[model samples]
Target: MNTHMEAYYQKRSDIYNHVRNASTYEKIAYSFLMACFTGIAAQIVIPLSWTPVPITLQSFAVMTAGIVLGRKYGVLSMILYCLLGLVIPWYSGMTGGLSVLMGATGGYFLGFIICAYFVGSISDKFPKSRKFIGMTGTLLIANFAAIYIPGLATLYLTMSSQGVSLSLSQLLMMGLVPFIFGDILKVLASSTFSKLVMPKEE
Candidate 1:
């Protein structure tokens, strides 16, 4: 029930923002525009062997958006970003639309936004903590939520659609196992950078 409400709000919060917060035309434009820009910036492709989805930096921007814009705007930015990728060729590989949304990597792509919200909201709200534990926890949780779930789910669905019999182990091998290290690195990097730019105290 909680998850359902979050999903419901996550889907439509952008509309709410537009209705209540459009006090100035410039604010409205900037918010929407920044959302699109960050979305495009996040569509990065990582070249690798035997991996279905190229590691993209979309999550980084998603995280940054949340930290900078706060929960509502950060999610809105991601929402706009996703919409653009769906309607225009602005995502990784310059791809977009329903086809892309229905594509194998789409789930992870969507996951980026969710992760950003979780990571950003937590870090922004609770900035004070021991450097090692809080930061690491922040990064770890964010990455797990934002990246791992969606990435693995996408791989599972895509492979299943292709009529491939993917065992739990095989699925982990292809989807989760390979990216753990890299995601850890991203978490560390994002945490460090976030701390520097937007210190919790402010």
Candidate 2:
């Protein structure tokens, strides 16, 4: 059993090395592609009447980018997505601009960058995380630490700026509670996809 575990870890390490040592052009290409994927995912939105935060596959795409691209390029992809979003109407509801970045969901947008980095770093550091269980666990933590925290804080601040003060429970209802089940599904999907796309040792 120990020998099998060692061999599995070695295989995962080989895959990580391949991704880490990818050519600059390849890295850039993958990052740009992920940025585009995130934009496309953002278009699949389910707007709710009660909350400004819409349900979208953006988080899944972001998590996938991290797992597939590793930390450096994953962060690059998110940065590209966010920066270009300011000039293109690719955000949710076909909206974009600086205003979008300052709106209720702005923190979630920022959280994407942080999420990508956090997930990528973990995947890169822990070769075992390439497996489904590990990847799912990592993404779950990343969702709350890197996404929901910033999202809820931003929601609170944005609402306060508009003279709409809400309690912590209320904030959670708007930004966290409604999305828990969906986010779990997203994490599972992202992990499954990552297991497929992440390199395997030859």
lDDT, candidates in the order shown: 0.67, 0.88
Poorest 10 consecutive residues by lDDT, candidate 2: 193-202
Worst 10 residues of 1 by lDDT: 11-20
RMSD in Å for candidate 1, one decimal?
10.2
Q: Cα lDDT for residue 151, model 2?
A: 90
C-alpha lDDT of residue 36 in model 2: 92
Model 2, C-alpha of 33: deviation from truth (Å): 0.8
Distance (Å) between predicted and true CA of 125, model 1? 2.5
Off by over 4 Å in 2: 1-20, 199-202
Residue pairs with clashing backbones, model 2: none
lDDT of 1 by residue, 1-97 (tens): 9999666655444543443366656445655776676656656677567666666666667666665565666677777777877777877767778
How does model 2 fare in lDDT?
0.88
lDDT of 2 by residue, 1-202 (tens): 9999777767766776776788999888889999999999999999988889999989999998898888999999999999999998889878899999889999998899999999989887786687788899999999988998899999999999999999988898889888889999999998887676564332
Q: Estimate each model's TM-score.
A: 0.75, 0.88
